[model samples]
Target: MAETELVCANRECRIAQGGRCIEGHDDLAKCLYYGNEPEEGDQNEADDDQEVIAPFNGVYLPDAHPLDSRRADRVLASLPSRMIGVIGVHDSGKTSVIAGLFDLFQMGPVANIIFAGSSTLHGLEIICHDARAASERDEPHSERTKRGEVRFYHFDVLRDGLLQSLLIADRSGEEYEEVADLAANATTMFELRRADVITVLVDGRRLASSRDRADVMGAIPLIIQGMAENGAFSRKPNLAIVLTKDDAVQASTRKDQVQRDFLAIIDGIRDAFASHFGEIGSFVTSASPKDANVVRGAGLAEMLEFWMKPGAEAQGIRQHSYSGRVFDSLMIEEAKRG
Candidate 1:
């Protein structure tokens, strides 16, 4: 029998039993001490396979910049457009109403309007962050929206296979408050002037609170008066008076009184600016019914439905009109009364 040859126990040793190591001392090209090393290409492919792909569902602002006007124009050109303006005071649930509308569309289509896309997904996300975080943490907290940043959320309205575009502008409540207090014109005021529909948000919680009631009720007429003085309501947009935080009001023992007070405020608006508004409708919404601390969206469908319908079709719900001469007479009468 031939002499027994000793084989190296190192699995990485490339040399045959009798072959010269190429690693200087033997025929193998490398040393077995470092173990087997994969080829560069193989390693790269392995890394590629392990890489994670992120979800790209919605479009966001570029570096927190506003949406491009050219892009907006291009979108508007192809489809019939409707512009909705949301107006309210600070902590009056403007953002919550917007967040609720966004949430409603995202879940599925709203009546005939389907979710086509949004240029302000990140903006919506920011507004709804608290509600989402609360749900995740099993805790409740209010969502605070940033001020001075007015963004537009775009949607594709689908009806009978025809697609139309709807753009809703979410303005900062503080901005409206400034205009109301100073009686000055701002960029948001211009948007309001051109909007096809306007949703005026009133915080029901504040309405129910005796401490905040006066200021809350006082602010509504001021905002409307400011807008009217600045010609923001010149085009006579359809109006939806949205009462937010409805759940809070309903739960309170003083619900009847709060409702009465809110109705009185609405009647005052009708008397003051009836001719400047077309097809006015009142809506009560609770954006966050499940968590009292954070506002989500509830009773938004009816509000959206009111917004989506045409002025002529919605005439039955009209609480006001756009009578130019009558409005002038009313303003004159109010001035004399003052």
Candidate 2:
């Protein structure tokens, strides 16, 4: 089949083609005058070139279901479902965690897990540090910078015959007050709404600090609770409270007390979450584990597997909850069902 192309030329009307606008006409007076009208033959040549050179307009590629396609049915049939959502918090190490997971999933034997690495979820990113910009107007505009809003990155892990992906959304660091304002007033709501799950990253070491504790703890829960009350959380998405910068927490401890400190910090976070939001699992994540710490280095993969497991919500609460093969777990469940 021969492909047809279209173009438009009216400046006011974005859709234009062949020196004429999609409206089928344009005012020559408003257009830049070339002093004289071109010959009909020349105009025709230009139109032909535009038709040849311009990309096809008003046509979007159609969506096709892989499972429904005859050629891909078998592979698609074996593919498992996906669970995805954005992880939140300014210091939450959201990007670092996602990046680490991408590396692990790509290199590991797990084929069922997939990572869709992208930053354009509905075309939004935390572009500016909103609070800083608002607070320091006296600072030179050049000195002020904005962190882009979070984008969605996809991670899929397929192993033991199950295929699922986690779509991670991230945002820039800003004060909770600003996030609340934006959440309440912004026209773009999907960024805050599109999540099958939401992992609120908490700064573990700072949880007890008086300087910024309230901003870190209170802001996040308030926003989440408000969302729940407003029906946004009706899906009752599984919430994962991640304690970011585990390395920092570990580094601050005495050599002999490292394990105790780690456990205590995690316990504090878990307790606080239970007190405030009623029991969410807390995972300690170290993006940059110290050399010689192989056990800690593997934390990312371990956490990913735990969080993405099929029945994690039910099973996560009761167990020591580490070192499970998600793909193997899924296979066992499916085999039993059959």
Error of 2 at 177 (Å): 5.7
- Clashes (N, CA, C under 3 Å) per candidate: 11, 35
Deviation of model 2 at 51, angstroms: 16
lDDT of 2 by residue, 129-238 (tens): 11123535442111111354333443345555555544554445453235455555222334444444556666644553446555665566555544444444433455
lDDT of predicted model 2: 0.45
lDDT of each: 0.72, 0.45
Runs in model 2 deviating more than 4 A are 1-83, 110-150, 175-192, 205-210, 253-279, 289-298, 311-338
> What TM-score does candidate 1 reach?
0.67
The residue-by-residue lDDT of candidate 1 on 1-338, one tens digit each, is 89644344343344444554545554333455323444667667778988999889997746422344445566567777777888888788876677777778878876656777666677666666666654574643455446755567676767667767777776667888887777765434545865779888898998999899999899989988888887787778899998888888988888998899889988999999998888899988987554545345667878877887665322223244456765644432224321
The weakest ten consecutive residues by lDDT in model 1 span: 329-338
With candidate 1 superimposed using the best TM-score fit, by how many Å does residue 169's alpha carbon deviate from the native?
A: 1.3
| Ten-residue region with minimum lDDT total, candidate 2 | 122-131
